[model samples]
Target: MKKQHSRPNILVVNDDGITAPGIKNLIEAVKELGNVVVVAPDGPQSGMGHAITIGKPMRFNKVDLYEGVEMYKCSGTPVDCVKLAVNKIFKGKKPDLCVSGINHGLNNSINVIYSGTMSAAVEGAIEGIPSIGFSLDDYAEEADFSHCLKYVKSIAQQVLDNGLPQATLLNVNFPKGNGIKGIKICRQANAKWAEEFDERQDPYGRPYYWLTGVFQNNDKGEDTDVWALDHGYVSVVPVQFDLTAHHAIPLLNSWTFND
Candidate 1:
């Protein structure tokens, strides 16, 4: 049997409210690995990337959902839940690992920038904690996660034993249902959205618009997350917070600013 502190203390979070089945499944998987805590949004917060509730007061309440796990529901963005967990809830205690998601949909390729699931994991990395985000390609409320729990536990166990690199975390995505064959460490694919807006009218006849898009992937690389998912493998991409274009710095230095 592993001793108390010998096993990691884990903080679990997600964008899809505390009540979502995705988080519930995640909580069960992590419990077998270590002590777990959950702090998540009170309602669905999809697409709220890295957003904090600075403009308004944030609130959270404890709930008894998962047995043997301490859980809280917060009225803030996914990032805010991490902030609250580290700063207020845990205070001086820092968790060994932070895991987000088992999100209802895919967060691969360019979707990371707009993903609240990834944002929660990003927040943990910002606070100097080892973090990881997990998502499934399925978007339905009843999406099957039976195939993901084994991989989730294995990956979480490995991260707990061997910590992640500084300033970097993992972005993991799984294909929906029981089709997953194995895990693949992959790079982020070059992809973007072919956007469209659906115009519609309300009961009052005022027009409103709903944003939609199809993904366009130009890169044909087989070592990318996109390719891995398409091949029925779970994709794990190591992500960094620094967005500096190191290659472009030299080009800017050659420009003459003196007029």
Candidate 2:
């Protein structure tokens, strides 16, 4: 970690391409906090969870956007951006922080499973770096991000000051309205999408399907990230990359498999 007085190196990334306004606002919010380096996808990579380029080669190009900030656009997924940022840009030197998103839409609850924004942060956590992913409840292209700035700065500063737990990163979501409550540290809500596919015939007489779904929040707990965002509060959920079902180990150990 850099000294308290020294500016720390921060790696900024996103699922929405580098030019997305959400990322621009994020840069504006956290730029003064550290020396910012941006590495993001060249195009939207939403719903691409933890995907990396393997079959084909991946490439990146330096961009002149975001004046005074070193930015690069990568032809890969959000996870790929993080990998390239660490291996190519930083040259194996892990940054002080890795922040992804200020995403175009909410990444609360079940959305985290498919969110490229959160995946970038997850990649950072895998690399043993303190990371965060921010999102707003609104999905509009021109969603107002005015209320999110202060919270972003606060959370980023806090993470910089007191690092996150081992192998964990944060998934933060902001409410849409202007009547903002306070920030809340909460758990991931038990929720999922009830999906359906709409089939239609095209002009060429071919059928295509569009996936759609309704979010179902079955968890009634008020301490969950979903509840926090629903009640006009900014929700912060600590996410872990470990997929071990440790709780089931004891039950499995009691089972007899000898035939």
Candidate 3:
């Protein structure tokens, strides 16, 4: 059994800015488990993925958002928020755990590849912190989070009690309704975004393209994240940052190299 710290230092981050209700509820869920420190984006950064702010200066300011919680708003991307928290705020002392999101919308299946919420958790895992990103399927600004609180607390506590494997983080997505069946540990669905660009004229008469896409899930496996989410169950997918295709190495070695 993993030993528990009396009060773990928990780093909380998100992509939906500091004032979003999603982050507020997330902080409330995990605050009792540790000393909560929030370092989040100042504005919405939903589809930023793993982007960091470069070619420009980044800034942070202390805020009085959540009472008794140390909070800061960063003028950068979600990943930048994590970097700043580790280097500037924590001063190289790694937090016991990191939790991202309670995001306003879903981050399951291929959506995880484009989600800033999950990217922050990925950054935390890369920094050797046990991390999890939570998201709800609802996209409304006033979506209710009450249904997800218990599960969020349980999952966070579980991670605190049992550290995750190296370079791995969890992408957890909750169904929008209150009648959620339960949690399901599942693999990422074989999915892609069917994309198209909508071209329209700007006010200045210049053509502007708006990117839009439909989520396409081709995997028929019942053990996939998408299936779990669709069946009123919360999906928890163990995500790894290592993008290497290790199985392809042996096939590549069989090719002849011309000198």
Q: Candidate 3, which segments miss by more than 4 Å at Cα?
A: none
lDDT of 2 by residue, 1-259 (tens): 4435678899999999898999999999999999999999999999999899999998899999967999999999999999999999899889999999999999999889899999999999999889999999878889999999999999999999988889999999999968988999999999999999999999999999999999998999999999998899999999998999999999999999987
Candidate that scores best on lDDT: 3
Candidate 3: give its CA RMSD in angstroms.
Answer: 1.1
- Tens-digit lDDT string for candidate 3 (1-259): 3757579999999999999999999999998898999999999999999999999998899999767889999999999999999999999999998999889999999888899999999999999989999999988889999999999999999999988987899999999988999999999999999999999999999999999888888899999999999999999999999999999999999999996
Candidate 2 lDDT: 0.93
Give the whole-model CA lDDT for all candidates, comma-separated: 0.92, 0.93, 0.94
Q: Least lDDT summed over 10 consecutive residues: which range in candidate 3?
A: 1-10
Q: Write the residue-wise lDDT of candidate 1 on 1-259 in tens digits.
A: 1223576789999999898899998998889888899999999999999899888898889999866789999999999999999988779688888999989999999999999999999989999888999999988889888889999999988788778888999999999878678999999999999999999999999999999999999989999999999999999999999999999999999999977
Q: Which of candidates 1 and 3 is the stronger one according to TM-score?
A: 3
Query: How far off is residue 215 in model 1, in Å?
Result: 1.2
Best by TM-score: 3
Question: Candidate 2 has which clashing residue pairs, if any?
Answer: none
1 or 2, which is superior by lDDT?
A: 2
